[model samples]
Target: MRDRIDEEITFRKLEVLLAFMETGNLSKAAEALNVSTVSVHRALHSLEQGVRCALFRHEGRNLKSTEAAQMLADVAQEVLALMSDGIRATRDAAGYSSDRLRIGSLYSLTINTVPGIVVDLKVRRPALQVELALGSNAELLDKLKQGTVDAALMAVPETEPEVDALPLFEDDIFFAAPANSPYAKLEAVDLRDCRDETFVSLGEGFVTYHGFVEAFRVADFTPNVTMKVGDIFSLMNLVSGGVGYTLLPGRVRGVFGDKVQFIPLRPQYLMRQTIGVSFLRARERDPNLLALMAVCRLRTRSVG
Candidate 1:
């Protein structure tokens, strides 16, 4: 009957109309929305102006909704619900899906750290489907920036401007050797003591690889690195088979089993891996990420 609903009519105006209609009082509607009563009055006025319709009748100090206002209030609830669902769907398509979580982690964490976190996350969000990715530290960071993964669990000290890190726990680095190796009998081994010993190390881009290099640097000599491998387990296996010794996270000792021994480094040369979750700062507010971070915080607190 009247002109078509104006383009200026917005979802917020619809919300204000619905709140006022349901409450039947401006003050009540304002209380619900945590806004001033005057603000609620202004929103209703704005809605009327935008739609070019009288949605309410002023009766003394109280406001009464007209027939048309009652009808619009009922429709506004449905419209708001539909708009919310549409926004959620759009976000899911843009990679912030709540139904599923895309996660990245280091190969070293697959044994213990990753599993514990995954199990805890599933327990907290039972309906959430988890997609796991494993890679070297650099590779996982790259995947995070590219949005190929929503969050990553990796060794920390990450300084990428776009990345937000939450350190879970600290893990000591140690020299891994065959259980039968002579050095296994000692409480600690200085990096210089193994100067002539052949070393099997993780390749560049892996966090342990950098730590290995720094340990040697502190010792003032280069290691006789015989092989540069990709995975920590492979490097450990090589060490256990008497191929060569390798430096690794002590937390993985349980994974490598009794075949390998983890010897702590001298205090001054000690390098600890700060294992944690890393994600884009932009994704910090994403529902899926917020849920994952909550689980991580609880788990880390229990461990600490």
Candidate 2:
């Protein structure tokens, strides 16, 4: 029976003995017991056989531990301590976790619009945290659907049924030119105005660039794109340096200051876009998510 019970002894008993040795006695270990010292002794009895060795040599009421017990002392302590730490980590990640609203957006909003909302959100919820992830419009919408992000500020197709859209503000796309350049002199220029002009197109996947390109095709023109770039910053730099002209979001003017001018879009070829807050309605009841939406809705109103 003892040999069979020895097979049942586990790392659990070794951990208990290690704790007992750290206190230098049995009485102190009894205080920390989930069961009883009697149970600990019973477990230890079977444990010694499992290891096929004597952990302690009992002398009257005192038990002096052997070499194997001493060897496992530090390793068992580390393993047990880490177990406690793991439980604490799980508790923290579960409830009363960090109070943060993780907002994602297309590259177009990452700089100006989202920052403005973040400033207002901090004012209303000072202790509330804000995190931003910037990506393509399609990728951002995917993140919103994934529950990884709280909300997305993007110009998505109006018919996306899985998400609820809270319309924020609308801005038209227009032709851009370096400050003091000839294109800036034009008050209202249609896509045809630039049919003979060199166009600098942004890379695929960007909402602004894709929108501008699609709108140009609608107006029956394929731009004589002299240059193509991946990012708005790079495209803007090219435009500023007179590499080529671009049709872009009006908000881009805010980025370059007086470095560029955004002339009015014409032929009423308006790619007037409604930027909005997109989120899953199923999580609408979450308290922190509500606070975040409230701030976004309020900011949109203020802009309107």
RMSD of each: 4.1, 11.0
In angstroms, give how far residue 198 of model 2 lies from its true place.
1.9
Q: What tens digits encode model 2's per-residue C-alpha lDDT throughout 52-112?
A: 7888888999877888878756666787788878866764453223478778887777777
Candidate 1, residue 123: Cα displacement in angstroms equals 2.4
Write model 1 residue lDDT over 202-283, tens digit each, in one string: 8898998889999899999998888888888788889888999888887788775779988888987899888999988988
Q: Which candidate comes out best when scored by TM-score?
A: 1
Q: How many clashing residue pairs, candidate 2?
A: 0
User: Any idea what lDDT model 1 has?
Assistant: 0.87
Best by lDDT: 1
What's the TM-score of each model vs. the native? 0.80, 0.64
By summed lDDT, which 10 consecutive residues of candidate 2 come out lowest?
90-99
